[model samples]
Target: MVYKELTGTSVRLPANFTGKRFLTIIALNHAMESSKPVCSDGITRDISAALIRNVTLEHAAWTETVICQKGLPYLLQSNLQKVPLYNSTTCLSKCNLIAETTLADYFPATHISGSKDHDISDFICQFLPLYTNETLVYLPNDHIVLNWEVEESGSQVDDFYVGLGLDATEKDSPSLVDYISTDRKPYFKHRHEAIGSNELFYIFIKTVNKAGLSNIAILGPFLIDQTPPQYKYIPRVKISEESILFAWESDTFYDDEQTAEINQLAFQFGRLSCV
Candidate 1:
């Protein structure tokens, strides 16, 4: 339920980028390039840590553009065709090393404009692709619902989806599950009763600004067995003197270290019927 925890360094972008004006959301879908050793807030942190800052401080999806500046390198739409997104940890943690040059180079001052902004402010862009990676877990019987809270003025979001696919097993594939996005909700749930017992699935969250999924929350691990249950039903007789003795295989114990299931049952029965 926790998102938007920023911990790295950020500087006020050049005045021309924003025209000293309104805010826009930037989502990077790429990794930052730098020759220098990575650090967080200019201090040496984990280089392996990822850069996961949100792109837009305050804005929506419609009013944005990737303006190809004159003679500047443009991001190829075909580049986006390559799947298996940038490498980073799970959702909500860490910073990826970024350089001023890298940021400026990727999102050079472009004339991007839309409805929300009357005047197109020079925008700030990052080197990495934001908002492309989203994660989701679905609950049935109402299946899902997003958090109905607003954090910032521009925290209103609604670009996401949720569906189920069976081919995506093992954590190595682009998950087949999708969730509809909403605003300011740590977790959004818009679908209903979508998961099946036989299906293996994944969920994707939508981000308008350049965002990354970091150290996400953990889930439950269920234990299951394919073997059937073994039982013993016995009847006994009332007797004046009774002594029962039973012995079974000690090997019929289930061990956590073992890969097999073991069960043992033994009983002594005495029966008497009289007229």
Candidate 2:
């Protein structure tokens, strides 16, 4: 059957039909002209119908099943496709098929709409810069905690992938090779033993939405130092007639030496009573 109008039409089949039936839908841009005689010229012209460029086809199928005692109609499959309607004059671009959703053993009372209104640009604008800020805190036993605050208004986060690498500017694909995958959470714990001590590392957080769109947030060139400072040599004390001096040498990690500095010296003495 052919549907000429740009509106939906419902067709009922015979009750005796039991095999699978195929349906084809086509959307045309211009209305087809009738073959009736309009002009006095004896020449005949061929009229062709052009198809609309951006055409989307949506279909849903279901089957009735008798399980136990109740007969329920379960949704078999539902799909949305951007029909690739192209002619010799115009070449249409290819687009990835939007994600599909399957409902089993049940169907909604009303029609469910797809994300056709939400375009790629809208999706990026709403979900870009996934997090406002991130925090990394060091813990004992070569462990650390990472936390971040996500934007309140946007697509919900589906999963998070945490990556630790030496190169902060590395691309997402290679950096996330050895990563820890987790669900939607504000914080993630990672052990530093795998990276070793006295080395700089960067933490990358990748947030993914239900539609598979992703954004990456990078934090740090953090230096992992589990080692503590130690005294290089024993302190030397020199007592003079007018002054007392004390000196000592110590060894500390490079990162610690940059921040920890000795600014003051204190000496405590006890009073002696002479007979």
Candidate 3:
């Protein structure tokens, strides 16, 4: 007797997540831990906070010294008759090599190389950086009044943008549109836009400098609607002094490993605002 097989629906299995080897990018929770150390630049390892006070707090600037006062001692100590004190400026002061160097034998000192403390800086030279702060300075109302601050400022800033965010998946192909700027500051699409707007839009921003567009600074995907709840006009909003407000016994901020599948289920009704 030949047995005829009857066709039936086979059970479908979930995706094989078990025992699968996959790559994961691990990052430290900066909020809970300290970060790494920093290095310093050479030549002028002796920096004073007074110097920063002297520098302008505007746009980032760089300065290079053709000749320097401090280099004479280093050169004279190194026993080089005529050495160069090449001092260059950069945004940061955490690098190798000396920035300030002296010109060889170009000393204006009439008498063969004068004394050490003979106003070395006066006979030599000095160069330092000056930066001015670039800001999204805004003025809300027009009293036709002037802002005493930034009255004598000079700037060459082109433009700026601000928005919500993008997912890590579509970092390459993003929908960059609906951008707006009025007086250099951006008033683009945020999560707090018209009702029903998505709370996720990439905040890609860049500035067109003298060297073309600078690197796109993706600040954050701020859920702008992350604001706490607000109260509206409720005239009879009376509350008894003997009212008791209750809450759950759990914290919200969690790591992916700790707040896995089963853990998320615990927050089904956890609409908390306070920490």
User: How many clashes in each candidate?
Assistant: 40, 0, 19
lDDT of 3: 0.27
Ranking by lDDT: 2, 1, 3
The candidate, 2 or 3, that scores higher on lDDT is 2
Order the candidate numbers by TM-score, best to worst. Answer: 2, 1, 3
Candidate 3, residues 1-275, lDDT tens digits: the string is: 11222234332334333222322222335484533533223111111111000111111111222223343322221111222322323211211224442222222222234423334422333222111111111111111111111111122345543222354233334444333332444223222233222333333343333223332334222222222222233223234588644343334233222111112222222367432
**lDDT tens string, model 1, 23-109?**
333333347442443333421112111221222111111111122223222222211111121222311111222211222122112
Model 2 spans with C-alpha error above 4 angstroms: 1-6, 9-141, 174-177, 236-275
Assess each prediction's global lDDT (C-alpha) against the native: 0.27, 0.39, 0.27
What TM-score do all the candidates reach, one by one?
Answer: 0.23, 0.38, 0.23
All models, RMSD in angstroms: 25.3, 25.8, 32.6
Error of 2 at 192 (Å): 5.1
Task: For candidate 2, list the clashing residue pairs, or say none.
Answer: none
Quick one: best TM-score, which candidate? 2
Q: After superposition, how far is residue 19 of candidate 1 from its true place, in Å?
A: 9.9
Model 2: worst 10 consecutive residues (lDDT sum): 88-97
lDDT of model number 2: 0.39
